[model samples]
Target chain A: MAETKTYREALREAMVQEMERDENVILMGEDIGVYGGTHLITDGLIDDWGPKRVMDTPISENGFTGAAVGMAMMGMRPIVEMMTWNFSFLAADQIIQHAAKLRYFSGGQVQIPLVIRGPNGGGVQLSAQHTHSLENFYGHFPGLKVVAPVTPNDVKGMMITAVRDPNPVIFLEAGALYGTKGEVEDGDNAVPFGKARIACEGDDVTLIAYGRQVNLCLRVADTLEEEDGVSAEVIDLRSIRPFDEDAIVASVEKTHRAVAVQEQWRWFGVASEVAAIIQDRAFDYLDAPVERVSGAEVPAPYARNLELAAFPSDKQVANAARRVLYMEEK
Target chain B: MPAENGNGENGGAEARGEGSVATSADRLVDLYREMVTIRRFEEACQRGFRQGKIGGYLHVYTGQEAVAVGFLDSFKEGDRVITAYRDHPHALLLGSDPKNVMAELYGRGSGIVKGKGGSMHLFDVERGMMGGYGIVGGHIPIGVGIAYALKYHETENICQLFLGDGAMSQGAFHEAANLAGLWGKDGQCPCLFIVENNQYGMGTSVERTTAMTDLAAKFDAYGIEHEKVDGMDIEAVLEAAERLTEQVRETGKPYAVEALTYRTAPHGAADFFEKYRSKEEIEEWRQRDPIGILENKLLDSDAADEEKLEEIKGEAKELIDEAVKFADESEQPPIEELYTDVYSGEDEYTGEA
Candidate 1:
């Protein structure tokens, strides 16, 4: 009865299960139906669910996005997908202004349980137009719960939870990990927002990240433990908006040194915000300067080599760790 | 008027009552009066802004009065309304104390939003007047999102979201629209998207900014039922809104209404109207001004004498004068109040030093 699956498959299962359980759940995006998604994340879904539920849209961001807000306002749990996080910028008004302000402005009269899910970050050499990390953009908003699930398990769990939660949730999945395979839990299980997961625990230094970067951090942790005898505690930030800073502070209390890592650039980036929070909350607990490991501050290039160099890698994380642990020259 | 017209009925055309109940001339006259009051109020506000009495970015919605008044007439006391920064008319139409609204423009503490938000950022949560947003097309999703909550609460209420043609171009409009369309087809969405297409988005005209000349046609993509209405004509706007809003309230489906109006003033007060539009164009729209049209209707019907119409105008002037006095006398919002209402600090324990 059981079968092995990819991370995207697990997410599909979560959506399928949630949709089946609740008639109110629906999905909408470009090419989500007949096109089966630009990635196979929604493959076979349209065939199973049909057009009414697995709705594809015309190339009109303002119209459909506003319609989604209207739907969420009406009470159906709609999961809206932008093909990429870059496309979401087109609908930023609906996301930030409308979805975020309705509840407070209505004085707690409504909840927009709408989820905008899509691939975020760069590595596929899609170049500047498609590649973007909107974690900070959405994370800056108040009425939204911004989620970045790295694992197949969390992707399933958090998405289901986001669909069921009372507020609007921005479910960000990394493009590079869509087809990546891993073990995942079965039916109906959901992860709560604002809660971080410890992918692999260690005590030497804390490695903080989320989405696809968490796996990269874990790989670096493995490299550090095997080669340099440095055990890195890897933390998945998960929900970026209501961030799980408690877990980060608790880990930093034990590890003393921290390296904030992300696929986005270092300047005024998501990781910088994290580093600031860590410094403010656990300033005295720091054994050294709160170091940051992020991508170079440049537009993501289309070529494979430049694309790889533009984003943070496991080796760069190791180098950051070496610098933090005083194992090598900066 | 047909009950099943536009998006007024639930359960297809069959699951509902007839489209609209005809109204007596008294009710129509009252609506006309409300529109007139809004016209005179904005004209005075403009004069005040120029005279240095009101210090803020005042967005006078001179031509788009009918959209708010006509749409809001369908809403019961408990129903909600939210819009972008050009919100004075909406506040006036939504039964807010006009004095408080005018005072808010004067930066008086007693004003709506407690004078924290000036012309472009008025908020009166008590009246379900969510706010006047400063960001272009920023408040659309939030308005629809709140509508989601209202329906969840099981209240047979509808939330009306009014935005400009400019906001219709934002991606959130599409995202929120897709959501509304899908949820609406299932009969769970109680949102009404009223695009007050006042011809321009600041400096750009709709023809320049968007591909679609008729914004109502934009709804066909989302599969939501909608149309374009003459915003200057109060009767037509009200007739259309009454039908559409009731459908949303009764069936829990969403509707879109594009009230095609033109702004007689500059997008905001700062720009000269001559830069984008011709003075003749403004003159033409002014001749068909909602107030003038209503006044003519009252004269034709003999609902009230010309003297009574003048008295109502005087009454509106007195109200504004009271508001100006109240705002002048009332102190500005104390600086310490800034930290308040930023968030619901109740459950959050930040452990601040």
Candidate 2:
């Protein structure tokens, strides 16, 4: 029987299991020890493993982040939390300049088995400063692996793989999905990165997304099938850096149309990359231009109504799918 | 507070003539030879830059050789070293192959980093030389992190992080210093912060950059032990490094050493105007040149004759000549190599997008 668990529980399970497996695996971040993390995802971990393993750090993002990179080089696996993805800007130099490019620059003499993870995407009125969708920002770099797992199973499985992988990983967790429940397989369910999960199979149009947007795409696919009588295929691009272009191309070939979605701003966003890949590899199979549904181009506002409008919705995803299928108005 | 003389406890008379950390007469001669090699290698770099053979920013370690050599001399096995862009000397001192170092500057596959890092990003991991970072103050935190790992792994070795006077103003330096100070309390951090106070931060003098000219005093804010050393004197730097490095290893605490020195060369090859400081000031610092002090010490102490010094110079010249020949004869990295090494699991990746 499949075991059901929340995203938060699954993430905590991943860390707890890894720490139990390897003594070198340690967790470090602000409030991660005493307060059990800013999101409470690491709740009771400190009590379980003590302060040395679940380290509590000061609010020195660049400092702790760079320290984790150094630890990784010395054969220690460090899982550094950013508290929020917005605060990661403080550690961008360490993350991008040092962590991402160290192994390549060092000619593969060093391997950074480091994971920098935290909640991302704008929702719940976090406003401009607190909210960010950094998949595109992190994925743009070559050496780093960027993974955005949508479900509890994917997050738990991918976290295991990320900790074990001998390269730095940017694990962008969705804050809104922490409480979302999903059926997760127990015991050694490590998911391989760069593989896209086909959430639903259809023939009319392909709905592509990742992270929290995958849930929206799944819901939209159902709506398209029931209300609009259109069968929409949904593809969850779990890993962004090692992009699953073959899976996307194959899905687009079957569907004959595609609609990319992202919570980041429209310009130069993850959707832009997805649309480009579809066009590049599945150009002949397309009956119409691939439509893109992305977050509005504005700093995330504080107001509830405005914040809701800032990000993509099921309605928007369904409309974009219709547009890709040439069934909705231009 | 003004910068005080670093050799008070050790006594300048004993430390200056005979290094406190057992600098045998032969070791002093060897150190002098290493310094000479760095100077000649950088001079070759200048000529190569003029001829358009070496591309990108070339920041040489001509004036601050003693800081790298003296401090690195104290490094034991398993000790890791990280520094900023003025890195050729550090790599050489830490045992990076001269041929690979020169070939890296030439962007050849035979270079230490397979010509990918170029001048600013030299790395010899096997020798525990972590990297030569391009960004100012960027490697400071990484240095602290390395120390944390060393302690966490229950290793006895420490990490030496090198930054410049200009990097003192960066937030990363302060943040890293604070973390080092905090982590050191638990005996989990053994990192040494070495600031190469080369009088200028790429044209901005130390005096103009900060109200507090004493860079060592800044470490007090982070609760780290701080001191200033006479960087021009190799013996003084070695004495300080020996004391501080031992303290770091014994206590597992971070320490800061501000080596007061001057760079005779411009910040980079492109920065030639020397408009930032007066020529008279330049000539004055040049008199206290690190190589000159060691050479004079070697001569005055009767450890070596002028002929012996010249012989060392000739050996360095010959080694540099071989480095240049190897770099010139080395092949360029193939176009296919550009795609490799980005990710570890190459076979698993399709390289499709």
Candidate 3:
């Protein structure tokens, strides 16, 4: 059974269900308790679980995040809210150095069942300091499990899986689409990591993305089918670190061409990895070179027009698909 | 509250209203033996580093033995102990096998943590030695969290968080201290912050690092009660540790103890240039060396004769020698170990492996 839910609700439900299912699961973040969370994803949760489980931490990212790592090491499942992925840079040392490496450094003596989730990428016009797409940045590390879920269903399912997983997970949410509604699974809809979700399947060309960019690719897939009679397959790479190379290779083998899209800079982004993977694994099946549609190389701007311009557009993804399909520029 | 003593000076036995004579001669001898073992173990490490038998940066707990030995004496079964890179003694005191510790330093598979964490990063979770972090201030918040969890679990156990005077300047320390104080209001943070004031952080002295030289008083900003102890004196440290650990455990609140001691050795094995401090300063601190102070007290109290003390030293030497031999003979970690322990369970490693 499934019910319609907002992305925010699905995320909250995952945490609530996990917390209720396992007493060890706790939530800690800035403004997550009494203030009802900066995004209200954990709103009203403190009333149910109380302050011990839904904790409001100080603005010290490194301190609280490191504390979460400690808690996880001591057998607590801590789900930390980053407010937004941009602020996670402050706690990068803890996340990258300790949380990501402690288990390996300790010779697997400790398991860090920890999750750090927050809004990612630019869409609400929060500007440069407040906006970042960190899937590739975090996915670069080996020990971390990075997931960027676009749909409410995947958000809930992956979060459950993340909370249950023994390793640390970097949960990147579609910040701009928090209120977007979708049919989410009823209960225990645990989605495994390292698997890509086939959002829409077609045969002409493969469009690859994750997070909010997945929505854009879906829109682009529709436009490509309606305007150019090109059937585009959208592959949502829900998991980044334990990436689904076989899925991309399989899709590319069938489509014979691919367009990798991302809302991050073209250099060293997830799209680049997709392009690399397609070339490395399915080079013989390619009808043309893989196309990459990426955001403009600029820090996110506060002005809505500039912010929209900074991110990859539906028209851009559609044109990239057209290029990979060897069709008209329009 | 224990009386805060003057900084960088030995707090005499009379300061705590205790005599030099220990109540139990056997216990004093045992403590003396443990301290000697640590000192000998550290001296062997220096030799290993010089002989190229040990790799990576090596920080030994040479002159600051009393602080760990004394404080760890108060360690309860469920309690946890965490510290920075200079963590050999904490592991030893927590009952981690000396051979495994030495083998870890030797980078052998038989080493604790399978030689993954070297001198800077030792972990014996079963013994309540949570970890020995390489980063100076990185482990402060972690220790605070461990304490918070202990209280969260409704246990009377506490976390003995040991850090250097240098780490007090880090934002992690202050932030964690604030959290400790905040959580402690409801008696949820039973963290015992043991500030091992070894004077210098690497090469810079604490005086040069922070305007407020009283490291213990800094905890006042976080509402955590703190005091200083003559770190060179084992009895003074033991007195503070016993009182503070119990207080933290019972109250479920955080406490701080700044043990004013000095590291008579260089900051690292390769730090041969003692340009930071003069030989005179080192010699002065050495006169009040923790081991020497304990030895003098034991001799004065008639706990043991010179011959008996020599026997203890000889035994410690033999023990450390055996540890070194075991480390020397132990094999390197299997190549497959490189891929293991990245994550738990099946598919433990990612990537090519």
Strongest candidate by lDDT: 3
Candidate 2 lDDT score at position A290:
86
User: A248-315 in candidate 3: lDDT tens per residue?
Assistant: 99999999999998888999988888999888999999999999988888888889899989988888
| Count of clashing residue pairs in every prediction | 48, 1, 0
Q: Which ten residues in a row have the lowest lDDT in candidate 1 chain A?
A: A102-111
In model 1, which regions exceed 4 Å deviation? Answer: A1-5, A20-22, A46-50, A101-110, A125-128, A180-189, A278-287, A328-330, B1-25, B47-56, B63-84, B97-118, B121-266, B274-287, B318-353
Alpha-carbon TM-score of each model against the true structure: 0.77, 0.96, 0.97
Q: Please, what are the lDDT tens digits per residue for candidate 1 over residues B18-46?
A: 22445455676577678778877888788
- Off-target runs (Cα >4 Å) in candidate 2 are A328-330, B1-15, B18-22, B346-353
Write model 2 residue lDDT over B58-90, tens digit each, in one string: 999888899999999998999999999999999
**Docking level for model 3:** medium
Question: Model 3: per-residue lDDT, tens digit, B1-353?
Answer: 11222221222222221424343556666778999999999999999999999999999998999899989999999999999999999999999999999999999999998999999888999999999998879999999999999988888899999999999999889889999999999999999999999999999998899999988999999999999999998888887888899999899999999998999888999896378899999999999998887777666655565767788899999999999999999999999899888888675546866
Q: Residue A133 in model 1: shift from native, Å? A: 3.1
Evaluated at residue A12, the lDDT of candidate 2 is 89
Tell me how candidate 1 scores on lDDT: 0.77
lDDT of 3 at A135: 94
